[model samples]
Target: MVGALAVLAVVLILWQILPGALNVPRYVIPPLSEVLVALTDPVAFPRYVQNAAATMTEVGLGLLIGVVLGLALAITLTQLPRVYGIVFPYIVAIESIPKVAIAPLFVIWFGFGLPSKVVVVVLLAFFPVLVNTIHGLRNVDRDLINLFRVNGASRMQIQVRLMIPAAMPQIFSGLELAVANAMIGAIVAEFVGAQQGLGVLILQAQGRMETPAVFALLIILSALGIFLNLFVRLARKWIITWERT
Candidate 1:
């Protein structure tokens, strides 16, 4: 924590002084103080908060859908190797396409509303969770599987009592990746077009040459990402406490 504080202090000092020290134009990189002022302005701050909340809603909804679908598909594939062989190649092909390219299609299909952004988030967040889940389930010890079989454990029992518990660490890792991807997906979808979101605010600020406000929005986004990442880490620690022992 001390190290983090020290780094943050250095970054703030640099942010405060660098633009003026380097004679950088305000249009390019506004001073940190100006951005801070903009961020704290009662009117501006509330707008920022509203837009951020909108984006976060999309992210959260998308992540929940993505995680549930990914876990369900992963389990199905693991249980049915023939189905896995048939489906995995298609999944790889689809994932190979840049998701941003598909965002426009979603916008067209869902309109310029929350649904489009949520869909984009789902697309972005799904792959990591699916891939990690498959890896975790497939990597279980053969000896453990045989032992369970010899002890007359059913396949469902093995899955519930052995595979899922063993896969928690990897699943949590995937969830961490999904959280970050979900944020990106939300912002990117908003960029394509949105009624209200941080991305829209950013575009409006850029158009009006409100460089400091734009910087302030970016700072808020970064802080949000950091907070979410830390939350996921704490949740993982709590959920998989057995790993420590």
Candidate 2:
């Protein structure tokens, strides 16, 4: 962890110095010090941080919905072969549509607000969860399934006791990747519509040539994304260890 922080510190220190050394305009790309100021300054921070909060809210809600729906769908696919056959093509179709193209329609249906952003995040987040979860569950041992049957476990019992536990490691790994994608979807959704958020703030900043603010907003989003992934990873590690012998 110290090594990683050292690398990040070196990168940021270079970022702080490099642009000014190159004599670049703040309009095109601001120096890291200026961007840091925009991020740390009270007035700009509150205004800019709202977008990050908005996107975070959307991501949280969207991730909840995505995990539930993905797990349910994975359960169906792993156990109900007929339903899986029927639904696989549609899942692919839904995932194939470009999110940017779909964002406007989401706005039209759900309005230019949090709901629309959640929809986009869920769409972007679900595929990873579904694919990984289905893969994990299907890869379960046939001997284990027979063991559950010999013990007279019901279908639900077998699924709840066996499949979910066995699949957790893969599911957690997929979820970490999904969290990053969800953040991206939330940000992109905000960019397409809505009055407040980092997306709108970024648009306004770009219009006014406030490149420092844009970079600051991006930094905040990246920080939030890292926080989420790291938290989940630590939680997953503990859970995996606890479940093992």
Model 2 vs. true fold: TM = 0.92
Question: Where does candidate 1 have its weakest 10-residue lDDT segment?
Answer: 94-103
lDDT of 1 at 67: 93
Our tally of clashes for model 2 stands at 2
Report the C-alpha lDDT of model 2 over 1-245, residue by residue, as the tens digit.
99999998999888878878988777877778888888898877777666677777899999999888988889888888988889888878876777657888899999987899999889878888898898889888999999999999999999999999989988887798789888888878887888777778888888888888889888887788889999998889888886553
TM-score of each candidate? Answer: 0.96, 0.92
lDDT of each: 0.92, 0.85
Which of the numbered candidates is closest to the native, going by highest TM-score? 1
Q: lDDT of candidate 2?
A: 0.85
